[model samples]
Target: MSLLQSQVPGNLRLRSIDGTERLVGYSPPTRQNHGVAAVVGFEEQELLRDIKRALLRGVLIVGGGSLLALGMTLLVARRFIAAPTDALLQAARRWRAGDLAARAPGAARHSEFGQLAGAFNRMAVALQQREEELRHHAQLLEDRVADRTQALREANARLEAEILERRNTQTALLQAQKLQAVGQLAGGIAHDFNNVLQAVLGGVALIAKRAGDPAAVARLTGMVEEAAQRGQSITRRLLAFSRREELRADRLDVGALLVGLREVLAATLGAAIRVEVEAPPALPPVFADRGQLETVLVNLATNARDAMEKGGRLTLLAEPVTVAAGDPGGLATGDYIRVTVADTGAGMDAETLARAGEPFFTTKPVGRGTGLGLAMARSFAEGSGGRMTIASKPGCGTRITLWLPAMAVAAEPAAPVPAPRPGALPARCARVLLVDDEPVVREVLATQLADAGYKVTEAGDGAAALALLAGGLACDILVSDLAMEGIDGVTLIREARRARPALPAILVTGYAGDAAALAVGQRVEGSFTLLRKPVTGAQLADQVAALLGWRETV
Candidate 1:
């Protein structure tokens, strides 16, 4: 191998021979055509040993330089990025844990970390401000709620007080209204009563002056009787208007009623207003209470007179009418007597007309009107199964119409005449027990009974009468006045009846209602009679005589 290697030049080759590696170099001749070569050979491991050592040195130096660069990078990252990141994370954690004051440490620097930290801090300040504002709003709301609750409580208390006061005021107003109505009625009554009293007084004075002259005395006495009758009529009218008297509905001739009311209307309306009544004689009779109808007519006449302040014509007319079912006037389907009272005077407006029949609604000045006139008239007409209507317009006068149910003519049974006894013998005188609380009344009644040929025993009161009866005083008839202080007439008569079951009794009372009630009871017992006062002495005598089966003398 050595001899062959000397032939090559500038060329080396590695060869493996006998499990050993060798390096071989070849050097060729300078000329291309020369075949001469030089060769050199060495072990391959020995030649590669120095080259491997140089490569190991280069690797060690490079590894050390890379490690130093890595260390520097780590240190710079820890100082510039990691520390700030850790601070931001810590601040975020603290803030999440409810530490609102916590801030990132790098916020003062001008780096990106500083900018992030500054933004985060700004967000925290905004959140804190929002939370405080919410708390302040909540506190204000709670305060307003409490204040509103207290205000409501006070208002409720004030409302209750106002209600109570209003109720009391209403009660007082109602009482005042009643008083006003009563005062108006009393004024009219006083005017009428004064005239009656004057007549009575004049007659009494004339009778006293002409006592010796029989004709003059008789005339004066008649005048006095007439005046007393007038007073009685006034009282009955007053009772009817006040609704104290019971209703006595009967068939009434509308024409006659209107004719009779003409004089009264003229007097009530004064001489200024001209009054006219036009009633058809053939008009059907109406079924209504006579007194109530009179009252209604009087009320209408007065209202017309008041409306005619400038003295206008007042006219009253009545006619027969027939109505069908569901009539516009709301009257029954039957014949009716339509009575109208019209006045050519200042009229009512629509509002006034609508409320014309409402009670306590008056157009007249406070003291001049009761306001119940039209209301009462309407009530009476409706109560009698009829209807009342009013028509009026401003400056067009007023007309009031009443539709009263017509009554069919019924045949009245002839009054039975008492049979004359055989030979017309005088009846036996009756013993009468007269009981009254007033001495003058008792004495006058006793004298009347005596003049009628009756044996009379007088007692001042029901108690005295009972005492006399219990003492066995013989009496065929018991006459007693109701409303006594002790043992009233009703009790006295009841006790007397127990002792004398067949004893005839006459109950005299000033109160018509009491007399009516007693009359109902007496009708059931057939042994008692009732007499309403303003009863004359002659009337009492006649009643006593009738009770005793005595014929009245001419």
Candidate 2:
């Protein structure tokens, strides 16, 4: 290599020394001009430069050692910085990938970095705990919803059943109302009819009782008696519907009534079943509407008869009861006269028994029975302040008890009123007041009483009757219809009592039920009598004569 080439790549000028270091002239190499000649001087100075280089090497040794130490520190710092950061980055990546189980670096080479890693670990744990809490809460919410849904379903079913039952009950009540209306109408018309029949028979009886012509009297008497008997039958049926008769409200010795009815009861039930009556002697009498009581009896008897299709013994029993269980067929406990009718026959289950008192539930084939008998009997009993109960099992027999409330004391038997003395008919000379709403009924009653020889005064309304009485009209007997438009019979009765307290009064009405009859009967402190509708001349005379103390005759 030439002098310029022989130099180190970056060395431009050479330093020369002659036992002392010195700067020489710098040379720039020309393309081909300079050769090894220029380097001779530089070469000669190399030995001297070698000595200077050795001296410089000794001076730089300490700094070089320091620099080596600094380089080692920097290498360690880079490794530490990258290690924690890499770990934190890797942990974050796992957390972000939905891995809650990943744990962040908690221990670190440096204090500050260790805390940061710990914070990351804490945050990850908190997130995992929150997720678990959310899952558990959601499960509880689902369970609650399921429970509520089931409860709602049960409530809906119960409500539907109640609604259906209410509908059936409503239908039955309406039918009962209709049937009651029909019965009331029938009873109202029958009273007048009975009166007319009584008059016809009484006049015929008068003629037949005394005539000497046996053949003619016998023929006429036979016709009249037969007609009267038929009339009596019709009246009996009407009374059954109206719940009225010659009611003698005594301590009803129920045992006696049942015993007396034995023969007839057996025939009614037929030879298939044995009808039995068991009554403790000296059983207390029940204070009740006798006709209504009989209706209950007949209804229960018939029900027992129907229950024993294959021939079974039916027992009719009576016991003087002092007190009973609470809620006996929804009746409160009380002192009662218990009449029991039991049948050893095909029994009823709960479902059938529940519908027993419904107006029209019949197990018999259609037209074989009308279902009103039991309902009417129950209504009558209830109206008379009594109750009834039924007990039965699936295969066992049925027992029904009539619970009749007892009176404070057993009433003494009433003395029978004597019949009119022979040919001692009352002087029909009294002036009478007749008040009624129905014009035809008023005319009929007035004509009958007039034919019997009484001076009859007629008024179509209560106010007219009251006005006539207030005007000092001479009146011996006051006859008034119970129900009227302006002033009813009750108001008129009060006014009449105020007008003349000793005035003889009689009330005629279409309604003769225990409730209605009691309403009037309770007001009988004075001499007031009630004659049910459809009164005849003879009954009219009988009641009037009884009230006014006039002579009575056939």
Candidate that would win on lDDT: 1
Instruction: Write candidate 2's Cα lDDT for 69-154 as tens digits.
Output: 99998888777767778888999999999888887674553577788888898899999999899999999999999999999999
Q: In candidate 2, which residue ranges exceed 4 Å CA deviation?
A: 1-135, 143-151, 154-251, 255-283, 287-299, 308-429, 436-455, 459-472, 484-504, 513-529, 533-554
Q: In model 2, which range of ten residues has the least summed lDDT? A: 35-44
Q: What is the lDDT of residue 286 in candidate 1?
A: 79
Kindly provide the TM-score of model 2 when superposed on the true structure, using C-alpha atoms: 0.44
**Which window of 10 residues has the lowest lDDT sum in candidate 1?**
2-11
- In order of appearance, the predictions have TM-scores of 0.60, 0.44
| Per-residue accuracy of model 1 over 312-392 as CA lDDT, tens digit each | 899999988889889776666888888999999899998999899998688887446657789998998888888889999
C-alpha positional error of residue 424 in candidate 1 after TM-score superposition, expressed in Å: 12
